[model samples]
Target: MSTEHNDLTAANREAWDSKAKEYDAKPWQKKIASQVAEALNSHADWLGADWASASDQECHLLDYACGTGSVTRALSTHITHATGIDISSAMLSQYTSLLSSTHPSLVLKTSVADLCSPDPQPSISGPEFHNFDIAGVALGFHHFANPATCIANLASRLKKDGVLFIVDWLPNKIAPGEHIGHAHAHPDSHDHNHNHNHVKEEETEEWKKMKKTIKTNGFTEEDMRKIFEEAGFEEFGFVVLGEKFVLEMNGKKVEKTGFIAKGRKV
Candidate 1:
């Protein structure tokens, strides 16, 4: 990685570490976890014996960017064991605490390592991830310092035919400017009122630079499909899950939408 890339990764790691406590306290985490679990569980059931009936020894999940183990906790009944990896120590600390109490059935392992690490992901508390059947990165890709490379590395970690599931934000606007801050649209409940397709004409130079230095709003469906395909995943599909989440910002309603994408490693 370039010096600049390394610096950004360090910054993101620190930010998430500090926010670990506040993040676990948020009610939104529970809601997001529930929706994510439902999607994974249903997909597992539909995938039949390949995913649904496999024994704990036969199938394991790698929950990439699994802060606080939210997705793993929600997926308790769907899969057998899981190994969650992240860059934040404090976040992993919180993840361990929750797992011991709220999700004992998960048979989970936690580690603190980013995609850039060269050694086998060493867990301060658990074990390295290997030969997993399902991999998920939930509400976490936008934090990646280099998403494409990260996806490819993650693909390498999975066994053949293993599935990957990703859930995250996909904002429809590009509010360009230095530190313009992330923008999320708010529509009526369960409504997808804004166009999520890229609008290049509306972007300014500041926005272009920002895309390199910081993760903007998030990845679009088409953007994600291309990335997954590049990472050697086949049969790509993306779908909006649940409903529009309306939040109040400065007394106005700001709506955020969520989407999930799944693919199988070829």
Candidate 2:
């Protein structure tokens, strides 16, 4: 792992661990999480058909940066089996509770694996994921200090013709803006809003979270294509969501946030 990626893993762990306790209770988080997962499932209808045509069985999917396994739980209905990995133990603990309560037999599993660390992946202890059909990341990836390298590692883990479904905050629109000041105007401005104590300190410090990080890490669309191609991915495309295209300037309703990249390993 690169030193930069290591730093990101640390930051990501801090952010998620801080948010884990309140995550389920936050209505917005719950709604967004569910929507992202369901959108992925709809996308599967398009991508899954290709895998099905290739004779793939019930999908074996890995949820990367799976904070509290919300996406994992949401994905259970679409795939045969799912496994979640994160660097935050607190998030995984919540994930464990959610899995235990629902989808107990969905081949649901969780592990602590820092994608930016030099260490090997913690034991998954299962026959599945050996040749997983699909791999996914939700609102993650940008947290990687070296997202290009992270993508390479993830792509290498897939079976031939496997698909990688990536959903992340796009720097183009969702990047943090002058909205901090505007946000202060909201009627619900409590201590958490003013003190910045509730949210991760770094989140408030950054301008556009992923943009600066990606530039600092030297990652780009070309970098993604190169890594995926080198890892034997045969097809690739992307969907930009939220922000300008999905919403009007008036902030009525359009898209929510971020973009999704899908690549097929061949």
Candidate 3:
């Protein structure tokens, strides 16, 4: 990876780490995360979306950049074992706590590892590495500084015929504007005492910026497919969630959703 990409990965890691604490406390975020998980779990059957169930087989699964395991919990219901990875320690901590409290029987495991980096490929070294039947990244792929290299690294860790699920924001959608100027920009930061109106405005602006930035970061249906294909994924196809996510785009109402592309490791 280039130095530029390395630096970007560092920044993303920092951003996620800072926001981890407050992210866990937000009730709305909890709802959204759970919803994402539920959607994936349900939609899998329709798209033949089993990462590990090739030939009706069961296998271990990994959730890359799994923030607090929102999707992990959803995936856990279907798969026997699921593990989530994030660069933020705090976020993983909260995920573990949540699993222990809400779903004790679920075998939810987490670790602090930057998926964008080459030196410390967490999934490959973790106890679960050899066990993973499929690896997934939800709404987290574009954050990589060098997406191509990251995709290549992730692909190397999977078993033959093992699948990879790449889920993220799709283009041609409405979204909220960026609110970093008014609301809490850091992850560990909180703004409970802030006025409701101010929060709304900030979130509105933030939503817009997010969409723009995601576009700038080289995110799109075509880009995702190319990256996965280049990294040795085959039989890839796109799947989008029907739910409309509310956000602001240039001060306009926007409903942003995601698409999941699944492929087999050739």
Number of the top lDDT candidate: 1
Which segments of candidate 1 are over 4 A away from where they belong? 46-49, 52-58, 116-128, 174-214, 246-253
Q: What tens-digit string does per-residue lDDT give for candidate 3 at 216-255? A: 3224567778888998888887777787544323344444
TM-score of each: 0.75, 0.70, 0.73
Per-residue lDDT of 256 in model 3: 50
Task: Tell me the deviation in Å of residue 66 in model 2.
Answer: 0.7
Clashes of 3: 18
1-266: candidate 1 lDDT, tens digit per residue:
57756776776676677678877564554555666677666665543324535454545878888888877776666677878788888888888887879877667777777774433544432324666788888877765657777788788777788888788767545433211222322221123333356442354543333334345455678778888999899978787866754443232344667787878888
Alpha-carbon RMSD of each model = 7.0, 7.8, 7.1
lDDT of 2 by residue, 1-266 (tens): 55656555666666678768786575555667766766766676665523323354566777878877766776676666777778889998888887878877677777777554545665653455456778878766645655556676677667777888777643322223312222222211222223345554333332232223222211235545665677667777766554322321121222334566778877
What are the lDDT figures for the candidates, one per model?
Answer: 0.66, 0.59, 0.62
* Count of clashes, each model: 3, 2, 18
Off by over 4 Å in 3: 24-28, 46-58, 120-127, 172-218, 248-254
